[model samples]
Target: MSALDAKKIAEAEALMGQVDSAPDEYAKAGMYFKAATAYRLAKSSDKSKDCFLKAIDCYENNKSWFHAAKSYEQIILLAKENGTLSEVEEYANRACSLYQQHGSPEAAAAALDKAAKMTESKHPELALEFYKRALAVVLIGDATHQASEFASKVSRILVKLKRYEEASKALKKEISLNLQTKSYGQVGRLVVALVLVQLAYGDLADAKKTFKKWGNRCEHQEVSTLQKLLQAFDDGDQELAAKVLASPFIRHMDVEYALLSKNISMPQCIQNGI
Candidate 1:
């Protein structure tokens, strides 16, 4: 490290010591916040995160949840820069929780959503968890539309991860949320996704059942199409299934399902001449 940076970090630690001995929590919060900034100037992100956390403790002790949440969010940014992969989720989760306690559920969800988008490419499973947590945060209020929106995000990540079973479950949850708000059109769209996921998961029986579950909800629009598609797969008719997959409904679905359509094939047992 540069000599200047070393000096700045040392000064930051001294500020921390002063905060520890301070009798007034408000003053401690201010000192810790300054120390956090000093450590950041020193290019010592780990130390910066610690100081922000200390600031959060003091702010929360003074019933300053908004300030505490803002400070905790600084730790999230520092963690993204220097903390371990595991630490990223931990810090983000705690930061969102603090925002929730501050009566800012939307802020909490938005923070996690940003973190998830940033992490999705390199750490999709963790990104999926973040999206799920965001959905939970949104569901804490009566914001049914927001809940449905986040739930769809959760399902999309699960699909991108190729966790078809989990994707089906997530889609089902999203459908339920939409139903609660009488969002029939949204439910219809998710119905197609759910059946597709069930099919991709190689659960023909469940696929049939799921299609039937939404038959009335979808105004029976997808019934015959799903039936023909599912039947083609059932009979191990790859050509027919491939043709069915080419329908505009499959082609125009979400990007994830659209990609899945291109890759769908009969199981190896059938391909291997079983």
Candidate 2:
């Protein structure tokens, strides 16, 4: 009846003609995509899906996630799948979100990672959403230390987003949850984060105190809590430096210290012995 509607029908008919006449699968796929677009414009979701499914089948056979994701979104919208999708994000991210909603976090995280690497800084907000979704799925139904470890990773991304307040809150929540359950490794991680946040805010004394409270509890020597202690010292916090050196966490640093001392002592010993 309307010019726009008629135009769309004409386009759909033309695409259908191509679909019927196309000699090869690729050509048929392209025609189906075009017909699907026209059907979508005409509010014919079922017809759109019919054509889109053909397009998607071809795309999947070709191993093209980009186009497959677009077609899958149409399928998802027509009650074929349950999930959320935002076309404004990257193609892989759309697929990732849908996969996450369908309870496949690992698959979702993988897709999100691919999209994140390709997007660069162009879509930080979308990237943050993917990271949050990954954390949520990883943490779900798990009361163990791994959940807290995942929380730390999520907090790291939040800090990158300059969401410092949220990062602090996340760290505090992780600490409280793990400490209540006696998840010492997680508590250590939280305390270390708290110390870093304090140092970021220029509260050297508090950072030093927090580190002292947590340094030896989780056997944090593997990660070298001394690295952070040295940072405090480098920042001219002499009292913090003294406290850190006296702390048990630094005891493990003896090997590194000895190596340095040996290098210096070796030269002198060699000079004298020679």
Model 2 TM-score, all chains together: 0.44
In model 1, the worst 10-residue window by lDDT is: 265-274
Model 1 pairs whose backbones collide: none
Best by TM-score: 1
Q: Of the candidates shown, which would achieve the greatest lDDT relative to the real structure?
A: 1
- Put down candidate 1 lDDT per residue, 2-48, tens digits, no spaces: 99899998889899788768889988999999999899889888778
Model 1 whole-model lDDT (C-alpha atoms):
0.82
| C-alpha lDDT of all candidate models, in order | 0.82, 0.58
Q: Please, what are the lDDT tens digits per residue for candidate 2 over residues 1-274?
A: 6778778878988889767677776677778888888877776667877888888777666656556665655554543222223432544556765565555666655555544443335556666665555556555645445556555555666565656556667677667668766877656645655655554444556656666666666454624764646464445555564555555553443242322212211122222433
Q: Candidate 2 at 260: error in angstroms?
A: 25
**RMSD (Cα, Å) of model 2:** 14.2
Between which residue pairs do clashes occur in model 2?
Answer: none
